[model samples]
Every structure is written in structure tokens, then in C-alpha cells.
Target chain A: MICMNELQLTVDIYALVITTLTLVNAGAVYMIFYEMFKRFYGAKLKFETPVKNMMTLCGMEVTDEVKHLVPVSEIMVFTFRKAFKHITESLTSEFESKVLRDWFFYALIILTALIVLSLIMGWY
Target chain B: MTDLNLGIVLVSEVLIYPGLMFLVATIIFTQWLWRKIAARLGFRRGPMKTGPAGVLQPMADLLKLLSKEEVRTALSSKRLPALIAPLGIGALSTVLLTTPLAPLPIWSPFDSLVVLYLILWATVSIVILALSTPNPYTNIGVGRYLAFIVAAEPPFFISVLVPIILASRYYSDVNYSIYKTSLYSSSLWGLNPLTATLMLLSAFSGFISMMAVMNIKPFDAAEAETEIYWGIFTEFGGPRLALGMFISFAERVVLPLIYTFLFLGGSSPFTFTDNYLASLITTLIKFFVIFSILAIIDTLMPRFRPDQAVRFLIKYALTTAVIALIASITLTFIY
Candidate 1:
């Protein structure tokens, strides 16, 4: 027969474990969502090009005269949209064709189901 | 001794043994060891002329850099951040003092959390220093660094939590809060097979992420010499460069020490004996083993492209971390 303290300890451990797993899952899902959204919608948000900056700093005399010919911001937005479309198309095709990607998604699903079952059953 | 004397002793303990001086010395020695080993592997004699098998090479290099004149470029701005960036290395070394590698673990509530934040702080300081220079190469390097952080941080953070959760399972005494319990405790190890396997996987994932954090090879895209001309560090030279090198070396030493503590049972292997020295020795041995593995990997692997590195971290590392989290939760019920 288990003592009351022993049972309580088990329950506490169980609670902590469940809470932690839930938090991790939620966080991972959020990151996946954020990454996808950013890839598609976050245009005109590119990091500055380092090599060009260094050249200009060194007085090599470089200029984006093309920007004066056409609006630089509009050109950037257009290129970013094209890049985003390309990435999305490639990723979609890869997801459809790749066995390993399918397996990974399946694994994630199984894992999620197990966690939910464990929570509902009060495994402690 | 009075309280004041006691305070002085504690301060000296942090500054001297198993602390700043000790960490700096060990980092220098380890950097030398890494170079020698890499050189031999590549069938070349490395640093043979410097103090007995190039043991003093790092020291000599440091001295040379310190003696050189400081150079500042016209494009560089915000002198303060650039000057203070080297101090971030010192801050990283301080984290070691609080770890189990010390003769005495600097007991604190949430010391683990503190260590995590300190690592981030040190990393961010470097990026800030890079941006202050207004160099294009540095900017690109900083961008790569940010992307690496985003991919690495999640898995690393999640994997670290596994041990914390495992440690919390054994928390019984009222005085021993979840944060107070040492993650290095042996109770966290030698579990049932399933949980043990999961824990090992988590450790492996954490180790990979940490390699990126430490800027080891393959993951060192931010500093790819061939492409970006030394990336974020292109502008730094002389004493500042020495400081940067020392910081990297210190990270190489301290990170493995933390890895041993969190995942390799720390000093627990020697816990059967009452002697603290034995425990410390065992812990040091474990640290060396992990360091050697990292060094070997660094020697053998080629650098990854920044995008590929981020993809690997997210796809592989995150999978392992999720598995570990699920397994840890399952094990909690069984135990």
C-alpha cells in the first residue's frame, strides 16, 4: 500500500510533467506558425547586405543608381514577393513528394495524441 | 572571522579558484590543445616552436595582439559598445563560477535560468559590437547569427528543460524548491530504458545546438572566412581581437563544463566518496571527454551554409527535443 505522501509526490510529478509538455508543444506550434507567416508575409524585411556596406565604407564609391531610375522600395517589394512565391511553391512540392516529411508529420501527430491521452487519463 | 571577512572570502573564491583566473587559464590551455590536435590530424606540425609543443602559442599570440597599436576605422561608430564587447567574455567566464565545476556550487535560486540569460547576454553583446562598426560583412554576419539563434534557441531551451523536469521529480523536501535542486544530481540519471534513451537524445540535441552557440565548425557560418572575410569580427584588431579570441576559447571550455554538469552526471560519478576533490576530478574528466569529442568534430567537419545550418537545427534538433519532452512526461508517471 502506498502512503499518502508517496501518492502526493507522484501526483505532483505528474502535474509538473504534463504542464511542461503542454507548454513545449504550444511553443513549438507557435514557432512553426510564425516561421511560415514570416516567410510569406514579411516582405521588405531583409537583413542589410554586409559585403556591399563594407565596400562603401572603404570609399570604393558604390551607388544603387538603379534605385534612382526606379523606386527602390517598389523594386525590393517586387523581388521579395517573387522570392516568397518561389519558396512557397518549392516547399509545397517537397512536402507532397517527400516520404521523410510525411513520416515526420505523422510522428508529430502520434506524439501529440499520446500527450493528450496522458493528460486526460491523469497518468499519476 | 566576522561577516565582512566571510564576504571577502566568498568574493575571492569567485575571483580566484574555479573562477575567472582559473577559467581563463584553462581556456588558453584548451585552445592550445585543440590547435595541436587539429594540426596533427591534418598531418602538420602546429605551433612546435612556441613554448613546448605550442602550449604557449595562445599566450604568445595574446601578448602580441596586446602590444600592437589599436586601429579604428572611419566607418566604425559608437565607440562604447565596441570597447565593452570584450567584457562580455569576462561576463561569460563568471557563469562558470556558479556551475558545478566549482569546488562549491554557487547556490542560488534559479541559477540555471541565470546561466541561460548570461549566455544570451554575451552573444547579443557580440552582435551589438559587430553592428557598431557599420561594416557590410559584419552586418551579414550579424544577420546569420540572428537566424542561427532563432533556430537553435528553441531546441536548446526545450532540451535543457528535460533535465530540469527530471530533477524536479525527486524534489521532496520543502526547503528544496524546484529551482534550488541541482540539475547535476545523480538522481536525474540511471532511469528506466525509455526515459534514459529520451534523455540521451535530448542531450545530443542540446549538444548540437550548443556547438552553434559556441560557434564551432560546420555551424560557424557567421564567421566563414572564405566568404565574408571573418564576418562579424572583420573590423576588430589588436587587443580587441585578442579579447574576442579569449572569449571564444573561454566559451569552448565553459559550455562543455555545463554540458557535463547537466547531462553527464557531473561529479556524481565520484559521489560514493566523501572527498570533494574526487568529485571535482571526476567532473573535470567528464568535461575533458566532452571537449575532446567537440574538438574532433570541429577538426573533421566543413562549415555549413547559413541557411542549411538553420534548417538542420530546426528539422533535426527540434524533432529530438519534442521526443525527449514526451518521453520525459511518460517517465514521470512510471516513476
Candidate 2:
């Protein structure tokens, strides 16, 4: 069995470490989904021709009035393409990388190994 | 008639038939307390016809539950955990055997550490077993159970450590014999005021959090009534449900005893005079104090949504525990 003092210290460390890991897990999930949602919606909002027309006619300076009145449907096809492109770009760029996935899997493996080791040591 | 002598008598009484009776009485009392408190909160007198102060109401309820037709849902999970969950909870009530009531030891070969471990292990096992049942409603209830456990267990473990650490540090002799000694006379960290205060605070927070985590009202997301047909208990009925409720009452009984023993100076209070009787009285009083507060809370407060409840505990319960630990450590050096 682990020494009592050592076990106490280990438990304290374990609690802190797990709390950190859970927070990180929550953060990563939020960030990934947030980015996907933002990009998808951003592209959709830019789809209207009137929006593009206003952007072009006003060139550098469109009235806020015309901007609000312009229906996004006018830009549907272009915006749809843009949205699809953004979705594809985000998914491929964010998750398709070998290194990032490897890092995640490696971290998971390391954490599992550490927890198993601690439980084993503490259990006996 | 001295306090120390009375304590010895109380411990001895616990070793005999009286202790078992005490356990039964606690279950009955807790049920009664629940009803009365629940009624009072709603501006009504609860179960008055059952006897004076509705004392016999528990017996009536017990009989009804015992005779009620068993209703097993057609789609219920057919597994050992489902069968065993209530039994496990019942067994957990037995683990309460280690708790001292009225400053009296309930049994021999008492290992404080083991008792604490047993309580946690039993409760966790019961919870896991209960959550394994597979109705979609039960599934959500179990999710809430998991969330509550996650929120509550850390604070509990931390709180349990306070007294153990104090005992280890203050008393020159190790071996956990400090349970026999009076808190007032004990050298708890050599009489540091901060340590004393933090120890008290930690014990209180631990008590509250344990009550909440154990599915006592306001904190009872896993067993919310209107939301999920008694939440995780959606499927339990008849004798099985009775057993589960009994186990819950037993848990309620044991929690206060554990808290009292660890923090309020175990078994010494009733040992002051007429040892057995005094100890019994003290135990009943302490248990009632703890039970009544919880019952009142259950009646008065609205049940919280799981997420909101978790956040509330994080702020109130966890913060107090952190503060207590800090205070204890600071006092260990300065005083």
C-alpha cells in the first residue's frame, strides 16, 4: 500500500490535475464548435446580391440604411458557395492535420497511463 | 456520571441490541420529519391523524409501501445492478453502524478511516447501480446523478480530511484513538483557534454538500418529482421502492452521525450521565437537528436545474471548503 502521507498528497494532486484536464477538454470542444458555427453563419450572411451591390456601389462606404434593408436571398448562390467553402476549409484545416490529431491522441494516452499508474500505486 | 464515563457506557450500549433499535427509530423519525417539514413549508399540518404530532404516520406509510402492488415497467432494464441498487443502498445503511450517536461508539474494532471509506464506497456503488437502469427518463435522472456526484464528491473527500488531519497533527499518539477524546480537551493542532474554526467550517460545508449530493431536497436533481417521475426512481415500486426509501432514510441517519462524530466530539455528550439512555437521547437529538434542517430545506426551497445546482455548489459549498482548508493550514503554522 502507498504510504498514508504519500497517498494523501497523490489524491490532492490527482484532484487538481483532473480538474485542469476537464477544463481543457471543455475549452477545446467549445472553441472547435464555436469556430465552425461562426464561419458557417458569417458566410451565409454575406450571400445577398444587394449586399454585394451595396458593397460595390458604395465601394468603400455603404450607407447603414441600404445594408439593413438588403435581403440576404439575393446573394443566395454566392453566399451558399462561400458558406460551403468556409465549412470545407474549416473542417479540413482544423481537423485534417495529422499533427494535431496525433497530439490529442498522445495526450489522451498519456493521461490514461498516468491515472492507471496512480490508481495501481494507490490501490496496493 | 462524568462525561468520559458516560461515553464508555454509550459505546457499550451501541454494541448491544439498542443500537439496532436506534437505527429503526432513525428511519421512522426521518420519515416523520420529512412529512412534517414538507407540510409546514406548504402551510399545512401533515398526517396528523396518525398519532400525536403525526408520529404514527411513518408506520402507516411504511405499511402502505410494503403492501403496495409491485409495478415493474415493461421496458425496464433486466440486470443485476437494477436488482441490486436498492439492496446496495440498504447495505449502506448498515455502514452507518460505525457512526457514534450522542458521543457513543456504535461498535467495536472501529476504524474511522474504514468507516468513512465504506460510507463513500457504498453510496457511490448504490448510485452507479441506480443509474444503470435504462429508461430514457431514468437515463436523464442518472445524468443528473452523475453531474451531482461529480460536483459534490470532491468537496466531501476534502472535508473528510480535515478531522483526520487534525487528529493526526494534534494528538501526539497516532493510531486514530483521538475519537475517544473530547474535542474541548483534545490538543487539536495544539489548540490553535484558526484550526478549530476551519475544522468546524469544513465539517459544516462537508455536511451540507453530502446532504445535497445524497439527493436531499433542493439539491435533488436526480430525484426531482415532476420532471421525471421521481427521477432515477421512475421504475422502483412496491417492496423494492420501500427498501430504497428505507436505505435513503438510513443514509440520512448515518450522515449526521458521521458528521457529529467527526466534528461534534463523538459519543462523549450522552456519556455524561445514565450513559446508555443519555447517549441514546443525544444521538436522537443530534440526528433530529440534522434531519430537521434538511427536511426544512427540502420543503422550502425549489429544486434547482442540474446545471444551476452545480454552479450554486461551486460557489457556496466549494468556496467554503477552500476557505476552511486555507484556514486550517495557516493555523497549523502560525498558532
Tens digit of lDDT per residue, candidate 2, span A1-124? 2231111123344334223322332233223322233344422333334333221222245432323222222322333344345545646766556334555446434543543453345321
- The numbered model that scores best in DockQ is 1
Best by TM-score: 1
Any runs in candidate 1 off by more than 4 Å, and if so which?
A1-91, A96-124, B173-185, B326-335
Estimate the lDDT of model 2: 0.53
Candidate 2 lDDT score at position A122: 38
Q: Model 2, residue A78: what's the lDDT? A: 35
- The digit string of per-residue lDDT tens for model 2 on B140-194 reads 5666776667667777766766665556445543333223322322244235444
Which parts of model 2 are misplaced by more than 4 Å?
A1-124, B1-21, B77-90, B101-110, B173-190, B266-274, B326-335
Superposition-based RMSD of candidate 1 using all C-alpha atoms, in angstroms:
12.4
**Model 1: number of backbone collisions:** 3
Cα TM-score per model: 0.74, 0.61
